[model samples]
Target: MTTNKLEQLKQMTVVVADTGDIDAIREFAPVDATTNPSLLFKAAQLPRYQSVVRGVVDWSKTQGGDINTQLINCSDRLAVDIGAEILKIIPGTISTEVDARASFDTQATLKKAYRLIELYEQSGISSDRILIKIASTWEGIRAAELLEREGIRCNLTLLFSLQQAMACADAGIYLISPFVGRILDWYKADTGRDHYPAAEDPGVVSVKEIFNYYKAHAYDTIVMGASFRNCEEIEQLAGCDRLTISPQLLEQLKQDNAPLIRKLDPARAEAATAKISLQENLFRWSLNENPMATEKLAEGIRNFAADQRKLETLLQQFWR
Candidate 1:
């Protein structure tokens, strides 16, 4: 079966790989790809990436920081290096994340993003090779705004509420990864249930809310629905601007013989009424007001940061 869904949805959306697995990415053939610290952490443990880890180790040694400190820095460095390598295989960009610890520090997030861009540039990749990943926090949006003004683009991740998205578009950032899977997870965790059907899923409603709001307002910010738990969700969002699926789901999609439906349309969006924007304070307050987003955002950051540390440990072992 051909993953030719992209052709059908050509006018409506872009397809993106949401995996660090190069083989599956090659199989599905998404033009662009995205990776978080968690995915990179898992990929770096494979023997094929052992040499990659060693390369980081050797590079880390030359840098003159303490061994563990050097290793941690090298893990971040390696994520960008590996992402850039994947760019050579795909036709479009690779996303490399900023440290999640910097999620609340606008200046620190900006600096880390710049450092990643510089790494890509030094490796012969241009600004277009990468999208700096940042949490969709108030500080993160502020950092993305700064990056946008400086010609550095960003992918706002860990997003849930409509508030985070409107602010990103207002700031003219490149993309927003409104997580579909995680949104479902939040509802499941709270209500102890699943929202699998498009019409029934409040999670689907959340992303649709974001997508329509962006399109109707003429915002150029790309909405890439991410972290999908199942192909049902993916099928429902087939005509979104982009959908970033894991390699496992991509394979499942290829195996399943079901026909895909186009769920969203700009023409349809054009007919819907628009929504108003919220200022920074209002957006922050609204996000904080949502119990699910507030708890999940903090939890997501901590989990991703822990994976970053584990990735660093793997690199140190590779060096030895």
Candidate 2:
């Protein structure tokens, strides 16, 4: 409403907070918020959250609980505690992820998603107030489909390719978080190219193509670009459905040295004609055949899984 270049462009892109630092989230005022195991792990290790963890531990002692269960119970407690507070600042949803270790198991993923929703519900939040975050694997998509049918919205994370977006659309997910920085990382590593400008970076290219495809086909799945390296990259993606930017880049946008303009406009794509239908058989074949999607999906699941364990260990110590 300010008509400031950056603030005006924000009207087009659904800005999201890509961090666990609640103070940063408050300052930036991102519409929605997202957090994963890695971010949660980092947040827990910080001295500020020490009180929350200790409170959970004290509660566990009062209940005479199992150590492992109590520790994990503590993580669930913290995720909801922080998530609900963020929701107070922003009128949109919060993305609370399921354990990534269950990423490959459809049933386990569904079970974890249900548990996550129940945790939120217990915290006085409705299913509509939260999105169950899942990895964007075939298993994850299928699980998302099941959750969607049950009225649990999902935010598909670690998405890097068109194949993943197609599958997510097929699954009727609430949103898909395409990682811009990670995509940039892969392209830079594979192509051995440095010096990525805002408009031409491979990561920017990937999200742009996905955006054009989604708008062209009128796909209902909201594409939220994540993990950016610079404000230019974010500015270039102005027309995306949503973009989860870090506080560092958000702060950079507040300073005005150059003009900010919208790069993506839904009105411009009104003439597009392609549309898609969900086909599980086709989805499976596509995910199986795309080597990068296959490898990256597995690798992402593993990396998040590792972070989950590390956080669990830290929670164990907190319980002690």
Candidate 3:
């Protein structure tokens, strides 16, 4: 019997399920799980999660707040409720995202993160078992830095450039999720090329660069390659510290019996000569210089924020 690719990849990287489907998480048994407002919102519409949504709605009514406040409260409650359920299935931590609208506000992000931690604590879950997900914006990084100091860990998401990764590292966050598929999508659209081999793939290149940079600097922040488009992309980054893959690709990997090659080596990272330290102005300008990163970063945030609003609207349907 040949070794399955999923099993092979597991030997080198920590597998994380990037979905809100409880059954999918159970089937894959990933080491960790991550969810965003969009995923939670999708799950809320399913018949199995109707009770989860209604439970939050009912609880929100008992608390004092306006309709908008009630909606926000219900959304947050539902996120943690879903997270709590996911935690029961996965032994590791869950990455519950803060509200995307608060992405640019450091203080708001901090307050919301604190609230999320409190909710988890109230439910008898330890703070160690949760990772607050935040955008990779400067403000978001600042908020994460503050939270990390107080013993709360965070996963910086929507990262598209080295500058973003470096900022997150400077903040000393627990993890950084550099999006791969999104970067590929941007390059494909811009260049009119639909096919890219793993070696030539812009997305794969971006992750490898970030991974090597992190290892070279000896930064403690874990590099998690996210938003994968295919199994080839996943296989190419076989030795990454972590890979949060969609269940679709995971299933694809399970079906393939092939030898997985470890493409990245920490030893090679020591040879990297490009090092950067950024001030506020330099960071902004550096990001601006990379048109792909700048556009994708903004687009990623806008899409997530839009999905968040959509999630809010879904909760409002049950308010009456």
lDDT for each of the candidates? Answer: 0.82, 0.81, 0.90
Supply the TM-score for candidate 3: 0.98
lDDT of 1 by residue, 1-320 (tens): 44444444444567788878777777778889999988998888766777777787788788887886787679767987789778978998898999898999999999899888988887889997789999999999999999989888899999987878888888888999988777788788788765456666766777888888888888899999998887778777778888888878777766765456789876677514456667878997888799877877888999988988777766766665
Per-residue lDDT of model 2, residues 235-266, tens digit only = 88997899998788888887654666788876
* Model 2 superposed RMSD (Cα): 2.4
Over 47-108, each residue of candidate 3 has an lDDT whose tens digit, in order, gives 98998898999998888789888888888889999999999999899999999889889999
Q: Which consecutive 10 residues in model 3 have the weakest lDDT in total? A: 268-277
**Candidate 2 vs. true structure, TM-score:** 0.91
Q: Which candidate is the best by lDDT?
A: 3
lDDT of 2 at 70: 70
Top TM-score model: 3
Which residue pairs in candidate 3 collide?
Answer: none
TM-score of each: 0.94, 0.91, 0.98
Task: Kindly give the stretch of ten consecutive residues in candidate 1 with the minimal lDDT sum.
Answer: 2-11
Residue 259 lDDT, candidate 2, scale 0-100: 65
Error of 1 at 210 (Å): 0.6
